[model samples]
Target: MSETIAPALLAPATSCGVFIIATPDRLAALQQLVAASGARLLGAVTPGNAAARLADQISLDLLLFDASSLAAGEAADVAIALAGSMAGRDCRIVTLLDVASIDAVAGPMFDAGATLLCNPSPTELAAALAGALAPGGTRLHDAAREREAERLRLLNEEVARLAEVLSQLAADPANGVRDRSSGYRGEPLAEPDPDPRAVRSTIRARRLRDQHFAPELFADPAWDMLLDLYAARLEGRRVSVSSLCIAAAVPPTTALRWIGTMHDAGLFGREPDPTDKRRAHITLTDRAAAAMRGYFRAAERAGLVPA
Candidate 1:
């Protein structure tokens, strides 16, 4: 592996500095992207040595890591190192990965609040770099870029709405969402927990819609993930971040964004794997679980099926 330090990096006062850790095959393209983003390419290093090298370069404004070529174990190590080293720093992180690498790499990256891209196009790469170096490069200069930005904006808005609703439903005692384990007002609720099979059947029905219609028309990552986690909770199973991403049936990046949003909204919580530090499982918070149960119970009472 070769490492190059651009001369511009020697004079940090002039340009935004970017450090890259990518595989040999992707190094050149990533360099080209960094250059195109108008950020100074501070240096390029291999994944194995990235953490040690990164620790020495504290002035870097961005860190770009491509984990597509790495084995799962190696990717996990690099992810953890990067997350630790960049904590509380002003630097932004952009991680490029494929579906295969997501299970190993997404957990740490998600924890670090890095932008994760799964098999993105060249345009997407350029846009991400520009977004990372925003305020100066935030103008939507093209139709495609504008559309993409609009999509992201809408996604955030929708998730925010869902989060607010979930919070309200779970907290409002009048909504019949009181603690199920203990009787509410010394009176036990007669409603039983929704059958896991019913939730699973709804999931299958949603997937079946893709067979006859455009899946994009009904791409609801927030709801899909909620149903999945609720069903898993009922089944006494744990859901890894990667497995939940798959359950979303959306792009991995999109799924991850929704997960992060929901987690921040207090609807989701992270549980570290007792056996594996590199992996973490995602779970619905007690509030979220209660809201889901209330929703199902409401649906049953209204003679409406769960969607």
Candidate 2:
């Protein structure tokens, strides 16, 4: 990687968010889409309310909405109105119609400037998001970027936790994060393990279990490189949500929404950014690292990260 090309891991941080609106059948899948892809759920709105309603509440990306079993005019009307509204802010409006309803609205929908998505899935959502964001410049979400982001996220969440205990011990000599860095070899770190007692504890480190992330696990799906971006800068004390978003290859608004989710999950606790009056920073809470550990173990086991 060229120095000018700052890999996703070293990219600047930024924030971003996304919205989904669909009927009952697609709701769960959409939520799952948000989780797997790192996008935010502004809220789920009904088809009736998609046009003249809830437009003010969320900025939707790929609005995979329903038009099945409705009059062609009605479906196109709603899509047109929403597309107009979405265009006001340059937001992308994507319409998802069943195969049966495609003919009714396909032409008009596309003519109205709506990107059409059919039978969407996690892959489709991720693809659509990547295409729309095209975030490669600072933080790419290509396979390599995704894996790196997830790995760095896990590393950050894990190391901070382990390091905190070390920091406390370094300050007082009693606590630690069960130092397993040593067992994981060829690591850029570990030989510099200053705390012997803590370092020893990790040699036979046990795998962390029940590694499920709380709701925040899905924060800012659009900023797929967030973890890498944030982790890359922790040493410099730049943990602000806005900075992290930029690093993570996300827009500011998107980053804030994800930060809120992490805050709710306790991965991020409330700590206003000192340098920026209008923005706030995210400090990895103690459990936050533990939450990320499970992912690290899984990624390493799967050969996704450097085991």
TM-score per candidate, in order? 0.80, 0.36
Segments in model 1 whose C-alpha atoms lie over 4 Å from true places: 1-14, 136-191
Off by over 4 Å in 2: 1-14, 58-62, 66-73, 120-122, 133-307
Q: Which residue pairs of candidate 1 clash?
A: none
User: Against the hidden true structure, what lDDT does model 1 obtain?
Assistant: 0.78
* Model 1, TM vs. native: 0.80
- Per-residue C-alpha lDDT of model 2 across residues 1-307, encoded as one tens digit per residue: 0112213222122233556666666577556655545455566776777765555665444455556545555665666566566655655555666444544444344434555554444354445554544444643445734564564476456656655644443444233345554575342321121222322222212112114544344433422332433343334454544355544333333343354444544456545446533233456665553433333443444555321
TM-score: which candidate is best? 1
lDDT of 1 by residue, 1-307 (tens): 1334333222223277899999888899888767656778888999877877987886988899999889888999899999999899988899998887787788888888898888877766666677676544443354643554565566456545555654554455445666556544564333357999989988999999999999999987778998999999999999988789989998887787778777877778988788888888899997677667767766666788766
TM-score of 2: 0.36
Total backbone collisions for each predicted model: 0, 23
